[model samples]
Target: MPNAIEFLFDVGSPTAYLAWHRLQGIVARTGAALIPVPILLGGVFKATGGSPPGTVAAKGRWMNEDMQRWAARDGVVLAMNPYFPINTLTMMRVLAGLEGDSRFGGVVNTLFAGMWQQGLNMADTQVLTGVLTAGGHDAHGLLALAQSPDVKARLIANTEAAVALGVFGAPTCFVAGQMHFGQDRLDWVEAAAAG
Candidate 1:
């Protein structure tokens, strides 16, 4: 068996959501622990000179189509959020704040579904609160924690560490010290874990 798989991801990326959806089964089969590392995609972009897919019109359209095809292949529901490129600073901070909490996984699931399945405007604080409440999280407390300096610093550190590790985008995975970027490379991730 391999070491724990590190999943460095941002919620704003639908491909990351797709990776999250498939990780559980992969881990179950491979007996590898799945570690979720919340990183700000924007920070990674800035550090790595990368930009979001929406920056290019044709690429954006093709990417959406590709996401749809992958969703169909994986039997996962993915509705493109109308508010594309929603600023994820607050969300990532909240995730960092909840880093070691038992409810972290639940929060991750709720937020991912809210963004990629329910098409919620995750950039809006009110909308985020409602989604979190509906998901049974303590929205007020979580939001409060998200604003703390510690959480912000943790997120920044995570993003910087990811960049230092050669990550340039969301859904970057590390299995057995081998890096795999993008949801399309999940097969490689499984193989690495199985070895």
Candidate 2:
């Protein structure tokens, strides 16, 4: 069986972006299937009784610098997203639609670039439509699908499933059933994959 790596992420997370960038190389080296699981960090925080970084000044301040260092090392341009920590419902919905897509990686990369590097307001219908269409997905149908009751339920279920898996933040990586959280933990993740 092919090794699987499940990645739970939210777009508002710089950590997620950093981890996302790092995963490509890890997948190549380890030959693990990259599985992206979209989950809401805000909801996860609530479920885990945690608060956003801004609510805790000391750690938040340190994380800001840490993020820059990781971005520099990873070579992923780290421009602060203008609309960040923006609601990722639409982004997640779009990604969920791509879960089974043949162009999954392309779609994920485009969404990350659009929201993080390009500073597009991901919540904007037109912006999302454009991103999907540009990526060759049906924009109009996706927009409607994103708002459908079924999609909403699935997104919530996604978050609940993440919580059940003991996820408390974005960028949680599950390798061979062992969980590794954060970009700083890549070494252990790689080890898990190797073993």
The numbered model that scores best in TM-score is: 1
Candidates' lDDT values, in order?
0.93, 0.80
Q: In candidate 2, which residue pairs get closer than 3 Å at backbone N, Cα or C atoms, i.e. clash? A: none
**Candidate 1, residues 121-182: lDDT per residue as tens digits?**
99999999999999999999999999999999999999999999999999999987899999
Off by over 4 Å in 1: none
Candidate 2 lDDT by residue in tens digits, 1-195: 446788888877878888888988988888877888888788899899976675577987788788888888888887767676687778787666666777667777777877777878877878877887887877787677667777777778989999998988878989888999887998888778766
Mind sharing the TM-score for model 2? 0.89
What value does the lDDT take at residue 4 in candidate 1?
81
Listed in order, each prediction's TM-score against the native is 0.97, 0.89
